[model samples]
Target: FYKHMLGRKVIPADLEAFDPEYFSNLKWMLDHDITNIVELYFSAESDELGQQKVVDLKPNGRALPVTNDNKHEYIQLMSEHKMTNSVRQQIDAFLKGLHEIVPPELLSLFDDKELE
Candidate 1:
């Protein structure tokens, strides 16, 4: 469907079968904060070479998303433990910008405190 929608040739079914090697790299990417699926998709579509170019660019994964109920508490814990400056900045930005698109009460669930 994706290839059809985009007017690109569909990858063959034999190739589409999940390769063990691909999964290993995919797992590494997931574990090490490498680019998520959405970012990968955007990068792939943005280029004429699609996935080939996206693979070359190698966008890193975003910082983890905050799931807890208390934003202030999460921030305090991260600050107390001396998290990286980049993580700290991401957290602060989320706190400031979260309420803009989200209901204030629901903001905590979707916000990535460490996302820049």
Candidate 2:
């Protein structure tokens, strides 16, 4: 997921090789109080790979969606977390985003009533 946000493809072997570098770089940024590190990285990448290919990364405050097929897993997570209203709202927003992206037939497995 971090790789995806970084606009890189997810290859396990590549990630294994890259993780140490990423950590060290992130540590340096943090130590230096570099709040715009992501922007800087994206700027450099955009210079190399064209602006269209490098998306501006921002935190949208949304959790990754739980699709219809993952409803049970979401339920288990809710149960474990005691299902607060804030969490429910986060889950609902995520599911709503998934509804926009996922095929309708597949998304139908998500019980709308349950979301309410």
Candidate 3:
């Protein structure tokens, strides 16, 4: 961070990275009811735990299967979890440290993409 602080580009925002094709397939499944929706659920690993443990997106989320009607909500929840909730603490910590060097007010100068 100290090194980057002096660079031309100080703090570049991290973009939400995802595979387009995966979503394309999801959209296709949503369109075609005939297409069998694969069994899936919103889940993640418990990073805090040393042993492998599953983290459900929400209460009873794991027990619930992804069906046609609920698939839309599933996708949305998945995206939200991955983009925001998953790394929320990490993002906050990073920004807190970053602000010590580069003020948050200065970040307004660069757009989200520009930060990258």
Per-candidate clash tally: 4, 0, 0
Residues 1-116 of candidate 2 have per-residue lDDT tens digits of 22222222333233224355644453444345333333332111123233333322223212334343433343333322322221345556665676578754664454533333
Each model's lDDT:
0.32, 0.36, 0.59
Instruction: Give the Å error, residue 108, model 2.
Output: 22
On lDDT, the stronger of 2 and 3 is 3
lDDT of 2: 0.36
Per-residue alpha-carbon lDDT of candidate 3 for residues 57-100, written as tens digits (9 for 90 to 100): 77877787777777776766665555556556776677778889
Task: State which candidate has the highest lDDT.
Answer: 3
Q: Tell me the lDDT of model 1 at 25.
A: 45
Error of 1 at 77 (Å): 7.2
Candidate 3 overall lDDT versus native: 0.59
Worst 10 residues of 2 by lDDT: 41-50
TM accuracy, model 1: 0.20
User: Any idea how many clashes model 2 has?
Assistant: 0
